[model samples]
Target chain A: MLKKILYSLTAVLILVSIYLVFFYAPIPVDPKSAGGDPENFKIFYFHLPIAISAYLAFAIVFVSSIMYLKTKKQEWDIVALSSAEVGVVFAFLTLATGSIWARSAWGAYWVTWDVRLNTSLVLFLIYISYLMVRQAVDEPEKRARLSAVFGIVGFLGVPLSFMSIRLWNKTTIHPVAELNYSTFSPLLTTLITNFAAFFLLMASLIIFRIGVEHLKEKGNEMKRKNSL
Target chain B: MKFLHIAWKDLKAEFRTKQMLNSMVMFSFLVIVIFSFAFGKESSIYISVIDRKIVDLLAPGMLWIAFTFAGMLGLSRSFAGEKEEGCLEGLKLCPVDRSDIYNGKVISNTVLMFLMEITTIPLFIVLFSYEIKNIPGLLLVVLLGTLGFIFVGTLLSALTVNTRTREILLPVILFPVLIPVILSAVTATGVLLAAGSIFEIAGELRILVIFDVIFFIVAQLVFEYTIED
Candidate 1:
């Protein structure tokens, strides 16, 4: 009951922080602009955090996979699945926001052969394959083990896919700048706060998903006992 | 000794059947031939407009494109044939190390891929009129790149061969995960074809070798778990 209350509180906080980002926080000026007064770049605050959050979700999948292999427990499998699902959601958001930003800045909606974009799409497909593989296999042990191996292999690609564009010297609209002290103003603070809220939201979702899996497991155990 | 026997058995079977090798090699040849007609004509245009190097530079990407697709076909069939024959279960029940099974599959897949590369390289040169001065370096890249593919492909093949949609799932699962290998291979190949100095291209080559080593170790370590019933 206490955990449920904490989850609810975190979910509410996430919504409130999102509201703050859209309405209360001052919009940032476009960094690429020259000479004019700063234009509202409020979307960047949301866009970047969501993207980073998605990558974090994938990292969770990777770690949980290792844990699952170590413990040979089903709980970690549940964690891995939930993270992949949530990671896919955030990854889609990243692509959508990225496309919107690209349109605003580059006057184009899409660019083929952009290595980063292509790899992200590939990552999404790979995760979808994970879910599909799980669904196709009837045996629980087989599903868990296969998905675990795939989760580890798929996460290994994350860094390589990200670096491929840079290595190939392909042009992408996404900015890759290091955050500095000067970049952290009032607007930046709100962005960081929003990021924290989203992170909390992700945690809450994973917890909820895990609860569902536990219930399913308990129900299966009871059914087996009753049959015997 | 026992592992080698199993591996040799697989190799002998592959040679006698020649199904996977023939399909892969044929597909690779068709791709190069089609590209020669479609893109080869435009090569001169690009050469006249850009530096003459563009044709050579694009050679690596073109070759990898063919190899990747053909390799996917080969990988999907790697374990499927065993599964179809009901031999995979017997192998799993064998007393030899699971890593040996992985190595055996990797070796056969590597051989099939190597043969495809051997057939395609000559065709690529003949069709593209590409100079063959750096034959040794290019062969080295092909060997390393093919190793990278076989390392990951063998694992993914095992993972997907039991699935309902094995054909579709292998590429979807394998390509994204092997981006590092593809990137490293393509870059190194491009550098070699462009006649870049060996020192200049060494970084990309090193990345390819490292990727091959890391994934090969990981796959071998994880194969037993993956094959568990």
Candidate 2:
């Protein structure tokens, strides 16, 4: 019951934050502005946070993979799978929001050799492969173990994917710098609040996914008992 | 010692069959031919005159592309062949450490890759009209790059061999994670081709070395779990 309440609270926070982002926050200065137009600035507030959250999701998967390897327990496998599922969701969101941002900023929807873009595409494919590998094998234990190993290996690409832009000299409008605290106004405050809210939303989604997996495991156990 | 013994056995088997070597060599020749035709006759002659630099620039990409595809072919066959022959279960039940199995597989894969590189470098020179200047640096990059590929490939092949779409799945599964290595190799080769001082390409070289170390450690650590029932 308490878990249910926490989950509901997290959902509310996320919804309210989304409302604030779209309706209440002041429009930001246009990133392209030589003089400071603000129409295109709105994407940054939403887009940056979602991209960061996607990375956070991958980090969670990486940590959970290490835990699974160390403990060799099924619960950690659940955590790893949950994190991977959420990572994929956030990764998809990142790509979508980024493409929109790119259209406004770069005047195009996609670029293939762009290192960050390619790496993200690759990361998404790797996770999809992870899911496929799990489905391909029939033995549950073998599936879990193999998936965990792949999860760990695949996460190695995350940093490479993230850093590929810097390494390859690709152009992106996203600023790689600390936010200027002095520039903060109510709009910045709201953006930060929304950022925190989305992160909590990601956490809640991962928790829900783990809970679903736990219940499925229990159902399998019960069916086995009945058969016996 | 035990790992080396197993690795030796794989080498012996490879020598007897020559299947992986033959395919990789043929594929390398095919890629060079395609590149030559794509470049056309005059450009091909010019490229051959500047052959050393062009080959140096293109070699890592060509080498890795060939190696990656050939490695995939080898990897799928490595374990699937074992399973089909009913040898994998027996091998697993033996007293060998799982890491030994990984080492053995890597050794054999690396040997095949090395052979392919050795055979193809001459063929690339002849077919592409590339002069083999800076042989030492070229060989060094090939060695490091191949080791990195084999390190990751061994583990991925192990995991993918059991999958339903093992052949198609290995490259998708392997390439994304190995991009850093591939990128560094490409960059380093380009730098070397431009006659950039060794100092200039050092950054790319360092990245390759770092990836090689990280993947090596991770592969060794994870191989046990991947192979376990």
Candidate 3:
């Protein structure tokens, strides 16, 4: 029942966010080019929230991974794996939406020199490789243990990777959006609403993914017993 | 003490065979030669006619690429060798903590990487006519960067050794985590090569040190899980 509520809530929030994003959010004037499309800025509402949600997903992976290592719980492994898979999807969405935003802002689909862009790229690659590590192992127990170790190691890199450009003192073309909380605006409302929507979506996806894994495990067990 | 014994055992075996060391050195040398040949046009004894500024720009990236690629070769072999005769099983059977095995591999891998690098740097200097402003700073950067690499690589080596596609997956998984190390090392090396003071590279050095320390400790803690049957 709670899962159904979560599912319905996520669906409603996502629809409301889409409406808010397309209709409610004020299109900002492009500061650089006077004639540039103001509509492109709308992608910001989706992009930043998705990126943050992806980070949240990986954070869950990190926590669950530690729990799996400590408690040796299969459920923690499920959470870690489910979160990682959803995180990778969200990471990919962040890149795609960010690319669309970049194409309009920078006149390129991709720019290599930007720190945030490259860091996101690296973060995406790291988790994809995490999934790859899972694929390369066949034994269930061994897979859980090995990927948990990688999940921990890989999460450690995320902060350093994001901080890399700043540490190197390189300039980034990516804009760091600062929210004005002093005055409540539609932009703020839209941004917060989108954040809620995307995070709930992530939660629903992970929960559903965990359920699938549970079913797969049961099927495997039944097969083993019947074979005997 | 047990870790030292494990390292010493690997070193003894390595020296007796000289197989991995020879291949690593040769591979790095070939990489440098190939890079210099591709980049330099007119050459004579002691100096190539390649623009000094261009060499400064290229040298750090070139040198580190050679080191990392060569390092990957050595790391992949580091654990794969144990898989051959169930040597890993025997190693795990020892009374020492599992992390000792991880430390031992880190030490041996670091030693082998340093040896390859020590030879490669001079060859690079002579080939590219590269001038070092601060050799000590460069060495520090190299040391910290190599530690970060080996710290993570050794753990992943053990982890991947258990997988079917052991060798191919190491670089795929290892390189993303290695971005900060490579970025800071190359930047610091570039700064040093261009005659900048070591203090100018303070940020990169700090990143390298922290990276080295974090991965070293983390890999030590998590390594036991990776090797478990």
Candidate 4:
């Protein structure tokens, strides 16, 4: 019942958020020199939420991974694996959309050493490697145990990646406002609404992915039984 | 410490076999040679050693490439003998904490990595025709940098050791984490080589120290997870 409500709420909220983002959010004048920044800055609304969603997904993966280690429960491993897969997808979306924003805003398709881009790329690579680690192991128990470690290690990356700015004292091209931009703008309501909607979407996506995993495992078990 | 004893055993084993030492040295040398040729063909006009402007730009990058790529070869194979002879299993079956095993490999790998660096530094100098203005500073960077690299690399090599495609996976996984270390190390070395003041490179050095400490503690903490089934 809760899951059904979440799914429907996500669908409605996302549709409303889309309308608000496109038609309602008052595009800001770049505080640095008025009339600066392209209207493509609209991408900020979508991009930031997606990026935070990916981090949230990773946070889930970290917790689920630790839970799996403590309990060795099959369900915990399932949750960790599902959340990581969802997180990676969100991460890629974050990258793809950010690059589109960059092309218009930064006047380049890519910037090699920019802190925000570089760190996100690293975060993406670490989880991709986490998934790859899962592929390389065959035994179910071993794969789960090993991937949990990788998952935990990979979370260390989130802070490291986010702290790249402070670590090197590099400037970011990403539009970070002096205050959290959400509060400053009239679009604040829409942004908060969108965040809540994305959170629901993430929860539904993870639960659905876990269902898929369980079904696949059952099918594998059936095949083994038939062969035996 | 039990970890020290395990490290001593690896050292003794390595001393008798000379396997890890020999392969790591040869690979490091070959890597330097390849870079020399590639730089000669590619970067010579742009970055000749006489032209300090570009020499400092490319040299640290080249040096670290040699260290890490050659280091990968050693790290990938560090557990080969144990894997094949079932020695790791024997070690696991023994009544000691598994992290001691991890710490032991960390010590041994660090020693081997330092050896590779010391041996290759002269080769890098000779090949690049680079004068070392700040030998101590450069060596200090190498020590701290390799300390960071080996902690993460050794932890990952252990994690990937049991997998079939580890040779390729080690770098794929290790390289990203190594970025901060590589950036700071290469930049610091570049500064030192350019005769930049010690104060100029201190920031990079501090970053390397921070990375080393963080990676070491994390590696030690998560090690048991990697060893368990």
Candidate 5:
């Protein structure tokens, strides 16, 4: 019942958020002066939330990974794997949407001088490697243990990569969109609504993925019993 | 410590066989030579237009490519011997902690990486006719940078050893996490090469130090997990 409610709530929030982002929020008047496109800036509504959701997903992976290693529970490993898969998708979306926004806002689809872009690229690569690590291992127990170790180590590298890239390129072309929430603007409302929507969407997807993993495990168990 | 003995055992065996050391040195030598052929005098036109010596500009990047690519070769093979003779099991049967095994591999890999670097740097100097303005600062950057690389590399080396395609997976997985070390190290090397003082590279130095320290601790904590059966 909770899962069904979560799925429907996510659907409603997403529809409402999309309406708010397109028709309700006010577009900035002075975007170009600040390196933003007046229209393309709307992508920010989805882009930032998607980026945050990716981080949230990876944070879940990190926590679950630690829990798996500590408790040796199959559920934690399943959660870690599910969250990592979802996180990788969200990360790729973040990069793709970011590139499209950059094309209009920064005059380039990709900018090496932008620390955020570089860091996001590294984050994407690290998690993709996490998935790759999963594929390369055959035994279920060993795979879980090794990937959990990688999940921990990879999370630690993100901040250092960000710092080093920022230090390496002292100049940045990435715009900082500072929203004024003091007046309770429609923009702020839409942004917050989208954040909730994406978080719910992430949760719904993870729960679904977990169910699939359980089914797969059951199938494997049955196959083993039949063989015996 | 017990880890030092493990490291010593590796070195003693390596000294007797000289297989990995020879291949690492040769691979780095080839990397530098190929880079020289590709980036040497032919780009003089572009270099002239830019009013900077191409060799001076590209030397640090070239050096680190040689270092990392060669270092990757050594790291991928670091656990091959242990896997072959059930040596990993024997090592596990010993009376030391699992982290000791990790530290031991890190030391041996660091030593091998340094040996590779020690050979490659002079060859780089000769091939590029590169002159170092600050030797000690450069060496310091190289040391911290190499530590960060080996700290993470040795951990991932063990991690990948359990994989089916260990060789291919090592570079793909290791390089992204290694961006910080390679970026900071290459930049610091550039600063030192351009006759800049160590003060100019304080930011890069700090990044390298933090990366080395963080990965050292994290890898130590998780090392046991990677080696588990």
Candidate 6:
């Protein structure tokens, strides 16, 4: 019953978010450029929400990873892996959309040593490498334990990289972290809805991914039984 | 004491075989040689007539790059010997806690990394035609940075020890966490080599110091979970 509610809500929220961000919300203007990012800044609505969702997914991974370590439960491991896989997808979208936005606003796709972008890039790399590490290990239990350790360690980069960027931003020539729209703007309304939509979407996707894993496990078990 | 015993056992084995140390030193030498032709003050290359200033700007980053990749070799092998021989199982049988085992690996690993640097640093000076005026400061930064490197490296080395892709997996797991370590090491080395103000170098050094302390404790506490069956 609850699953039905969640599925319907996710579908509605996603459609609403797309409508609001694409049609209802006003496009953001770049203060640096003439005529502003009237068209390009539109990606901000999608990029920002997905980025936040990615962070949320990783936080879930961290908590579930910790719980897995404490209890030695396979369920928690499944939760972490599911969250991470979803997180990696969302993270890639965020980076891709962000680059598009950067190209329009900054006139370049990448700027080296810019703390915020570099931090995001590094964060993306760390988790991708986490998935790689997971794939490299064969034993299920051992893989879970090792990947859990990595999940925890990789998430530490989120806060640490931010701090390093903020502190070390002084020496570098790159522009400071982006602050596109001011607070209390109408855009905030769309941003909030998009945030909610992405959260629901992430939750829904995690459930499906975990369902897929469970199905795979069941199939493996049936194969073993049939062999017997 | 048991932790020391594990470390001593590793050291004794290494002393006899010299397997990890020899490879690490040679790898650093090879990397430095390549780096020199690419960045050395006087070289015949497409990026020709590279100035002293450019080399100064680059030396810290290059030096640490060599240290980091070479250190990865040592860290990966530090556990390869244990996992390959099924020696970790024997160690597990002795009833020592995971913390002891972790510290044992970190200590032995740090010592071997230092031994590699003993040879690699001299080679770096000769190849780059560089002289270290602030030897003590550079040493301090290297020690703090290397500790942070080994702390994360040893943990991930053990984490990947049982994996099919252990060789490739160690650096994948390690280099990301070592960002602060490597960044600060480069920054501090640049400052010291360029004879910048103490105030200028202090921030980067502080970063290395903090990284070493936090990661050392974190690695010890968390390592047990990684090793569990």
Model 6 scores a C-alpha lDDT of 0.82
Cα lDDT tens digits for candidate 4, A23-121: 887776674312236578677778888889998998999998889888989899999999999999989988998888877777677877678787778
Q: Lowest lDDT 10-mer window, candidate 1 chain A? A: A33-42
**Which TM-score values does chain B get in all models?**
0.93, 0.89, 0.95, 0.91, 0.95, 0.93
TM values, all candidates = 0.90, 0.90, 0.96, 0.92, 0.96, 0.92
List model 1 lDDT by residue over B1-229, tens digit each. Answer: 5667666878798889888888998999998888877775655433564645567667778899899899888888888988999999999888999988998888878878888889888988877766666878888888988898889888988988767678787887787677777887898888777777677767677767877888888997888877777
Indicate the residue-level lDDT of B76 in model 3: 100
Model 4 chain A lDDT-worst window of ten: A29-38
Give model 2's share of reference contacts.
Answer: 0.51
Candidate scoring better on TM-score of 1 and 3: 3
Where does model 6 exceed 4 Å of error?
A28-30, A33-37, A170-184, B40-50
lDDT of 2 by residue, A134-168 (tens): 77777776777888888888888666545543465
| Model 5 stretches with alpha carbons more than 4 Å out | A33-37, B42-53
DockQ-superior candidate, 2 or 6: 6
Better of 5 and 6 by lDDT: 5
Position A52, candidate 2: lDDT: 75
lDDT per residue for candidate 6 within A1-228, as digits (tens), equals 887799899899889988987888875454643123557766777887898899899999999988998898999999999999999999888889877777877777876766767777777888888899889988898889889988888887567656655556644333333545675367788888888888999999999899999999999999999999
Clashing pairs in 1: none
DockQ of 5: 0.88
TM-score of 1: 0.90
Which candidate tops DockQ?
5
Q: Which lDDT tens digits does candidate 3 get at residues B61-121? A: 9889999999999999999999997899999999999999999988999999999899889
The DockQ scores of all candidates, in the order shown, are 0.54, 0.56, 0.78, 0.52, 0.88, 0.59
Docking class of 6: medium
* Model 4 segments more than 4 A misplaced: A31-37, A161-169, A179-185, A224-228, B41-51
**What's model 4's lDDT at B25?**
89
Poorly placed runs, candidate 1 (over 4 Å): A28-40, A111-119, A170-173, A176-184, A215-228, B43-57
